[model samples]
Target: MRATAEPAIAVTRQLGRFIATSSWLDIPVDVRREARRTLVHWIACAIGGSTHDTVERAVRAQLAMSNHGNARLFGRRERLVPASAALVNGIASHVLDFDDTQLGATNVHPTGPVASALFALAEIRPLSGAALAHALVLGIEVECRLANAVFRHANRGWHVTGAVGSLGAAAACAKALALEEQQIAFALGTAATQVVGLREMFGSMCKSLHTGRAADNGLTAAMLAAEGYTSADAAVEGPQGYAQVLNGATDLAGVVGALGQRYEISRLSYKPYACGVVMHPTIEACLRAREARPDLSARATAITLRVHPDVLSATGKQSPRTGLETKFSVYHAAAVALVHGIAGEDAFSDAMAVDPHVSAVRGRVRAQPDEAVRKDEVHATFSLPGETIEEHIDHVVGSVTRPMTDADLERKFESLAGEVLGASRCGRLLERCRGFEEISDAREVLAAATA
Candidate 1:
């Protein structure tokens, strides 16, 4: 009777090696299909967010920094360095605060890292739709697995997208390059050194900067590894390594377990509101209540929101005065939803935040955390003229249970794309995204989106 041995660190390293080089033929059909969907969604987000001042500024600034390279800028005609382009485009995709969100991993935005890396590589390698699709799947798996491994650790203070996403981004870049298993491992180890971000800066520009830095670091890691740059093989598991020094709990075994079989990216939730995901349900509840009784919110004495503890961490402003601040204010979001009966991108503008009526109501609104409401759901109650009406939203529109309809997604695209390309180009871009998987040339999709 011999005792069985536990899986070694070598096994985890092997899994990382396998993931970086796995091709379309290696993954299942369903994973491949889901990958295409994720890519289309990522493109949609980038196109929609291109109109943001921050995104536009960042892209323009990066363009000035480097004049060489062939990587395509989202919603623009010029090309920049692969790494720089990814950083700018990744930030643009998330700059407006409208992007895909994973339910299980509250703070991880998959497209920011994966799409950023893939598009950067695609410009250089001219990857096929199938190859590009597979890369996205592999990238997503890496991001989500790292997300799972570090989410609890992230909850303590680490920004997983910054810390773990750098590694994911490198993994994606290695896949796109079709690197050898050993090279891929080297890339991962190189990426490990660059992982860094703090959740304390969630409400400001630095929040999105995390995504940008991760995108840049990840691509740089792969490119450096490809050129024979070296990193410690024990980058993840060694004492003072990624798991120990950075996150304090990286769960290497969990990250590598079921590497090819389980897919975590397909479970992500799309966002309807261009604000923090935590505030979405509260915004929706206010909208519903307003529609049900319009006058109630108009004359409300006070409003109260019951939400999970993370809301305050993600988007809770006790007293906010600016438009950018409103994006992270549940009170302001609720006020906008009630006053305008919607929480679109316009609702988060500085003008709207300072509106007499919105400000008046926002002053009276209060938010408190409740153990009963999960981080993804919320319970909001409005105290109006005659009564206190309550609504508990388990799933907001664009969330898993109440997913956004095609029409809803189109509406979001129209609002953002219209700001830059005008109505004609916007309409064409939306059409291409709906049928993106069938396209043979990735340029067709990019051209249609930026036209």
Candidate 2:
């Protein structure tokens, strides 16, 4: 009689088979629909981020340092090395701070890993849009499952996205390569050893740097696996393995539980703004207050924001001098949104961040955690310029609760893509991604994006 496989072995077998066999058609109709949405969301973020000076500098720096030959940079035809391409593209996807966020698994960002890996592969392979979308599902599954295993670890000191995301990147790359079960298992196993990041780097560019490293390392792992690099198949759950060693816990079953049934990618939150996810609600509040109290500038004495502890911890930028700093600073974003009635790409610019009037308002804005408010909720009360005008924001306007309409997503796409690709190319890119599953070759779609 055949013996039952160990849980780790069973999980590896299941994940390998799932990655090997799962396709767009196998995914539920609703999931396929959401996957398309996620594609649009990630592409918008990448396009929006491509214009950031920081991303440009990083891309150029990588090109100068690395010897890898030319690979396509997102939003442009300029080619850098594969690793550089992954770094630049990954940073672009997350730079605008407008990528999709997974609420469960402690609100980890999902697109960075999948998009970063897939784009690098697209530069070399013949992957289809359907295959890319399916890879996203598998990548998100890997990230969320690993994150779920290490949820407590993130609290202890790890950045779940960076740490678990490395493994996610590897899994997605492996799937995109169509690796065999043993190869996929080994890739995950090898990637477990490479996982690393800390929450201490949250405020700096280094925070996003973690995602870049995950994409790079993940691609490396896939290439190594493809080249016959061998790793222990049970790296995730072996004695003193990834779960116990890195996370201080183990849950092989949880990693594979409801594997085919429950879908995490379908539930991700696509951002409508380019600031921190925690700052979105505050952005909405400031916009609302600006609309309501046009003359309250003199009346507004102070603005108080009651937010979740996590938000305060994650996005509480006390004083921002640059757009990047402002992205991490709730105080800056809230102040700008209320004063200007909008927080667009330019809102976080150095000119705006250093504006004396903006600084004055930012000084008055205070973010504190209140247990009564939901973790995702941002309640804002404003003291007006003429009279004290107060509003309680029950939720962010463009959140999953009050999602951005398809029209809103289109507008966001146009705003981001048009900056680099022009309106016509942007429209073509959006149409191609929306109908991604039907494309025979993804390069044609990618060509449209940059054409």
Candidate 3:
């Protein structure tokens, strides 16, 4: 028998070379626009969540340990070290679970770690808006591709964002610093070893912390690499490395092929609701059902929600006890959307979790998994008095099929960032982000966001 040889592809170093050698010109205009859009969305979420209790406690903890640096978190006057700032801002961006989501590999939040780490570094470095946008796109691409290469969310407990975000963060930080290919490889290696976050932490504050730690660890990895810290260049695919150790996958064809041609950032989707993406469709369907039947609350009956199989695995919580927990509860989402016709931050509050009306509706939600349903699609049925009401959403709002407009995003940003940054400041920040690619210095964003 002839022995077939294994294909050779240097996954980690190749990625590093792409990151190190790629120029801003290599990124297309639309991709850069989407990247800038992502930054705007991320900043809005960060500012909106800056006052969240999670951010409050995390900032206190980091400051208590000595907050000494020039790094700035969104909508906050407090200054922490670069690494601490990344952690605090990352947590703030995701505390409300309203951060932008990219379902590339395993439903990961694409920009939090990369943007958090990059913004932290920008404060200490002379990063231009174009450079920041380029690095941000590359960072997001690396994590999404790496995740696509080794994702096993169906049977595994790894929170893909925490598990794979470090690589993206390290890549972005390294690019922003202009590290050599070898050093970028080392940064990735360091990040590959520090993959953290578990699906079990989904509903808890630890879930947001996973993103913060990934950003902090990734920034540290790049800094260490710049200072000559080294690791196996093939850390991502080597023996007992991230892929094999975590999901037991070895082939990294997805990570290396189409390196800089097809961008994953353009595919990035925004969130209209403040909860998990898994519940968006259900919420949309429920809200539509209410609109279809104005007397929905009076005619409330046996409700059934058929969603993607992943939805059940991810957001199957029936009796969530807290607002954060409610974000992961499909029942609560459907309940609130139908009852209140709104699913904003207040809809998922700690108080809403225990609301009698919301709970009553939540208790009656019958959720089942359907393989045919996609993450952005939902099927709902309501048993009314005279007739059975059914609504099916092929592509929920904010999905790729029906993406939010730039004006829609602006309004969204204004509503969320306005409360914290105020009308004048929020408008300026929004304009700055809209023209981010032309700015000479990225740190100006930090100054503009400072409360």
The ten-residue window of minimal lDDT in model 2 covers: 2-11
lDDT (10s digit) by residue, model 3, range 237-280 = 77667777888887788888887889988887899999999899
Worst ten in a row by lDDT for model 1: 3-12
Q: What is the lDDT of residue 103 in candidate 1?
A: 62
Order of candidate numbers by TM-score, starting with the best: 3, 2, 1
lDDT of 1: 0.75
The per-prediction tally of clashing pairs is 0, 13, 0
126 Cα displacement, candidate 3 (Å): 1.6
lDDT of 1 at 291: 85
Best candidate, TM-score = 3
Quantify all predictions' global Cα lDDT against the true fold.
0.75, 0.76, 0.89
| CA error at residue 111 for candidate 2, angstroms | 0.9
**True-structure RMSD, every candidate:** 3.4, 3.4, 2.1
User: How close is every model to the real structure, measured as TM-score?
Assistant: 0.91, 0.91, 0.97
Better of 1 and 3 by lDDT: 3
